[model samples]
Target: MNATETFDWAAAGESLAESVTLIAGGARGTGRTAALSLLQLGARVAIVDLDPGRIATVAEDFAEYGTDRVFTAVADCTVREDVQAAAAATAEHFGKLTHCVYSAGAYRAQRPTLDIGADEWDLIVDSNLKGAFLTYQAVIPHLQRAGGGALVSISSLAGRTSSPFLGCHYTAAKAGILGLTRHLAKEFGPSNIRANAVCPGGVVGTRMNDLLSELHREQDLVELAKQTPLGRNVHEPDVVGAILFLLSDLSRFVTGATIDVNGGILTI
Candidate 1:
């Protein structure tokens, strides 16, 4: 039997069957999709978001998963207390936390560096970078108590290169996430915790896509897709698959690494 025949494809998802995952900024978009996928894999999930309405709506979406396996917390990821509280609540509700996914970030309209205001920079940086820091800080201890875990941070292709549709602030924040993820992987590896990053290109159905649609002509969008080796922009599932891999034991020995889900648009 070769590697292919020996591989247990059906057991690939079983590694996460006992997982308890917390998704920061999980109310919508890729984060929301991740939550649903985790639940489907037989893992318990806790969703933390800044908006109560989104929390309610996503909770409804997960209603079939039942209350025992799903938890929701409404808190601002940028606030230390809120994030700590949410992490604590998640652990208390789920019994343990085995994985964390930081998908909370913001993007603003494209503008020249000179035209970008200080406030806008601060907001974007704090939301994308500081929020990840806080979420990691709050969850790391819980993971420690649980013996070990994994962390997956959602960065962007903009961080790897540049964004034609967003400002420098978004780029900087996402780039910061890559750095933070590496540092966490180094700092926590001794504790058995793993950390990795996923950089996805312009994903369809995301707010970034909405902004792109508004800013670029149809031909421009087509041109953008044509540039990628895959001949299309990334979709939610493309990124979610990467997230699920990092969260599962399949990536047990993989840490301090980056998996780009950018359809080969920007290869290093």
Candidate 2:
């Protein structure tokens, strides 16, 4: 390579048509959006979610892409065997696994530190942190077999700072994701696999919003938008863009890093 030679950044950023990506918690929300974006870029995607109903619904919508390009699996991310099976199935169907995203998580009604019970903590931790661990463990070997891959896990703004909208369990689980991502990045870089986390602020019109609405704590969109420096709340697309970048060659050298997708909130 000479100084006169320029990197083909645009081509580098494009997802390969032969690429296969597996996404957990991809039935809806940010995960679904990212899966769609990757598919649009010509990558085959295998989406896994615990809810068979949700998977069916999303599959109905994805069927237009044809079965060769879209695959669906029913698996619980918290269960190691389930995650392992999902990974195996994905690789079997696609013939290779080139990328993975652990985007499955949940946020229930806020509970004070003292008021939160062991059950609540267990549920959140199992879903958010342990789930990510299992997904990472199950997928990395396949990625190594494929020579290399990219991984991005969805975290949250509350993970980085205290938030009025999130509970203790939710914050702790998301924070745990940051540590998990960094460790994987460090341990797997030699294998040519990169790992990163995306921390998104308040994102409306997501299943999280549905949870908030059920808790009677869903705030006015306009009010929440005003609080953001960008003058709008982050949406699924906003987060998906960052996720895609990290999962693409565009961020080949970026690993163990937490990219904020918040609307200029908590710029640390």
> Per model, how many backbone clashes are there?
0, 0
Top lDDT model: 1
- Misplaced by over 4 Å in model 2 are 1-5
Let me know the TM-score candidate 1 reaches against the reference structure.
Answer: 0.94
What TM-score do all the candidates reach, one by one?
A: 0.94, 0.95
In model 1, residue pairs whose N, Cα or C atoms come closer than 3 Å (at least 3 residues apart or on different chains), thus clashing, are: none
Q: What C-alpha lDDT does candidate 2 achieve relative to the native structure?
A: 0.88
Highest TM-score among the candidates is held by which one?
Answer: 2
Could you give candidate 1's per-residue lDDT for residues 1-268 as a string of tens digits?
2545666655765878888999999999999999999998889999999989999999998999898999999999999999999999999897888889999977786778999889989889998999999999999999999889999999999889878888899998999999998999999999999999999988887585578667774466678789999899888999999999999877778999999998998899
Candidate 1 root-mean-square deviation in Å: 2.9
* Models, CA RMSD each: 2.9, 1.8
The per-model lDDT (C-alpha) reads: 0.90, 0.88
User: Lowest summed-lDDT stretch of 10 residues in model 2?
Assistant: 1-10
lDDT at 217, model 1:
48
Off by over 4 Å in 1: 1-12, 216-218
